[model samples]
Target: MSNASRFKFFKSHHVPTLTVLKAAIGDFSYAPHAHEEYAFGVTLAGRQDFFSGGQFHRSPPGNVILFNPEEVHDGHSGGERALDYLMVYAHPEQVKPLFADVLGHERGADFRSRQTLIQDAPLRQAILELTRLVTSQAGSCIDQENALYRVVERTAQLGGHVQPSQVTHRPEALLDLAREYIHAHLEADMSLDDISQAAHLSKYHFLRLFRQHFGMTPHQYVMNGRVNAARAALDQGTPLTEVALRFGFADLSHFNRRFKRIYGMTPHQYQRDIAR
Candidate 1:
C-alpha cells in the first residue's frame, strides 16, 4: 500500500450540527463503528469497499455511500490506488425537516435503508455540492443552507421510504424576524446570541429552527449579507479596499479570498470581466 495520504476531521464552523471528513488513504482499514449522526459521502477517486447490511459493497468514483444513524459498517481501499472522498455527518434535526418537506409530511419518517449506495448523477452532484459548501468558508449562508436542503431532498426522494406527516407546521413569523435583523445589521458584528434574542429564542433552539427555516446559521446569514453588499459595491467600481472594509471584512486579502471562493474570481478580475 502507498503512503501518500491525508485525513481531516472537523465541524462546520457555520453550521455547528454538521461534521465533515476529507480523506485520501492508500492503506488504511476502518473498524466497525457507528455514528450518532447520519453519514454520507461521495467517492472522488479510486475505489472503496465496505461491509454493511449483510453484504459487501464497492463504491467507485462518482458513487455515494449513506448510513443512517447507528448503522454499523467498515471500509477499506478496494485497490492499490488511494481512496479520496469527502464525507458529512449531520445531526438528525438538521436533516429531518428536509426529508419531511420532500415527502410532503412533517413527522415520523426516517431513512429506511441499512447501507445504501447511489449512482444517480444528479444526486451525486447535489451531495458533492453540499459537502463543498458546508466544508468551505466561502459562499453566503443562504447558498450553503440551500445546498444542504437540496442534498437532503434528493437523498430522501431517492431513498423512496418517506411517509407523509398528518399535519404541517410553519414558522414564518420567526424566520422573517430573523431575516430582517440579519439584513439590517449586515455591516455590524452579529452574534448568535444577538440574532437569537431578536427572534426571542434560546440559542440552541434558535440554531435548529433557523437552519430548518433558512438553511443556515445566523453567522452564515450575516457573512453572506456582507458578501452580497461587497459584490454590489464592487459592481459600481468601488475601491476594493474600501468595499471590503465598508462591507465588514477585516482587510483586502480576506475580502479577495472570500470573493474568489464565492464568485470564482478576485475582486479586480470580477470588475475587469464586468467592464468588458
Candidate 2:
C-alpha cells in the first residue's frame, strides 16, 4: 500500500500561547530536534516510538507524552500502519503559571521527568478534548479557554515540577499596537518588519511575543484576518474572485485553500450552508 500522510496546524484564540498539531503518518520519521517550548501529545492510533532524554519511548494508542522546553527528541512510526496523533506546542511562560495554580504554589517549575510519558486514560481524554477545542472554530472563546486551563492543570498534576517564581507576561500595549496594525492593513500585503516596527520591537522578538499573545504567528494572524474579511464579503453574495482580490489573496484558488484549511469547507460550501 502507498504511504498516506497529513499534518495540520491550528491556532487557538482563547489559548494564544499554544499551537495545535494534528498528524497521521505511515513512513515518515522525524529527525532529532528540540523545541523551545513545551511539546505535549497523545497517540490516537497504531503506535509511535521516539528517542528522548537518554532512552527511547514507545507510545501506543491513548498514551500521552510531554517534553519540556529545549528537550531533544525524534519520532517515527512503530509499525506498518500509520500513526495518528494530536500535539500541542505551548509556550513555557503560559504553562508555568498554570502549573503553579495546579500545585497551589508560587514557585515556577518544569515537568518533573525528562522522559515523561503517561498511560492514564482520563488525562488522555482530557488532552483530546483540549485539542478538539483548540482546533475547532465553532467553540466559544470562553469555553476554549476554560478547557485549555483544565488540560494544563491535569498535565501538571501528572508530572510535577518546582521552580522559583512565575513568568512575566509581555506588556499589553505593544501587543495591541501590533494587532491594530494588522487589522488596519488586512487588505494590504503586510510584512513582519512592518508589524514589528508598529510594536517598536525586533522582528524575532515581536514574532515570539505575537505568538504568545495571539496563539499564532503574525503571518497567521494576518491570513486569518484576510480570510475573515473574505467570509464577510462572500456572505454578502460577492463573487469569489472579487472576494479573493479584495481580501489580499493572490487568487481564488489560494483563498479557497486557506478558507478550507481554517473552516474545513470551501467558499462555495460555506455560502451554501449560510444560505440554508
Candidate 3:
C-alpha cells in the first residue's frame, strides 16, 4: 500500500487504542479528509482556522478541538505564527467499551461534537503535561496513557460546564480511594478478592468497574503499583529481596519476572540501568 493508504489503515486500526503525536512545523494546510477515529487535541501555540461540519472555526492558542471520526475537515494557518500542537487519535471502539461500562450507558452521544474549546489554565496545563508525556521518548508508555486519560477527563469536565447534561459519573473519588488503599497495603499479601473488598465491589463487578474507571484491571493496576514502588525502592538502594516482599510478591523470581514483563529488564538490570 501507498503511504496515504498506510496512514489510513493505521488510523482505522493497528495503532494502539489511543495514541498522540506532537507537531512542530511551519504553516501548512491540510486538505479536507476524514478518519475512522476521534481527532481530539489542543492548539498549543499558533493560529489556525479549521473548517469542519457546516462551518469554519478559527483556533488559537489554548483552543481544544474534538472532531468525530470520519468528519470532513480542513486546516490552514490564520497568520504568521507557526503551529505547534498535540494531537491524540483515539478509536471510538476503544472509548466506547470504557464509557459504556463506566457510565452504564449503551452508547455515547456526541454531546460536544466537532470539539469543545477549553481555555482554562489548569485544563491547559494538564493537556500540556499529557502532550509532553505522549511525545517524550524516554517516558513510560503506561504513564503517558494515564496522562492522556486526564486530558480527556478534563476536557469532558470543562465541556460539561457549557452543556450541563454532558457530565458522566465522576468516579475519580472512588478510584482514588482504591489507589490509596493499594499503596498502603502493597507490602501485605493481597489478592483480587482483597482489593475488590477494599473498592467496595464484588470480585467480578469490581474487576470490570475498576478497568472502566482506571483503564486497567485491579490486578494490572496493583502490579504496576508494586512495580513503581519497587523501582523507587531499588533507586534508594533497597535490597532486591526486601523490595519483593514489600510489594507482596511471592518471591524474588516472581517479582523479577513481573518487573521484566513491564520494564523489559530484570530487577538488577533495571537498577544498573538507573545507575548508569
Best by TM-score: 2
TM-score of 3: 0.47
Could you give me the TM-score of model 2 versus the true structure? 0.57
lDDT of 2 at 50: 86
Q: What is the C-alpha lDDT of each candidate?
A: 0.71, 0.73, 0.60
Write model 2 residue lDDT over 87-187, tens digit each, in one string: 88777777777776777766634544434788877777877887887776658877876776777777766666564333444555788788889889888
User: Which residue pairs in model 3 clash with each other?
Assistant: 66-114, 66-115
Please list the residue runs of candidate 1 whose C-alpha ends up more than 4 Å from where it truly belongs after superposition. 162-276
The per-residue C-alpha lDDT of model 1 at residue 14 equals 66
Q: Tens digits of per-residue lDDT for model 3 on 1-276?
A: 111100000111122554554554354455454444566667877775877666788788887777765455667556666776666767666555443443345543333353545456765776667655544433666676566556556555554312243334445555555767887887777787777777676778777777766545677666777786686688677889989988888898999887755333578875654443
Q: What's model 2's lDDT at 223?
A: 78
Ranking by TM-score: 2, 1, 3
TM-score for each model: 0.56, 0.57, 0.47
Which ranges of candidate 2 are over 4 A from the true structure? 109-115, 164-276
Q: Specify the highest-lDDT model's number.
A: 2
Clashes of each: 2, 2, 2
- Which one wins by lDDT: 1 or 3? 1
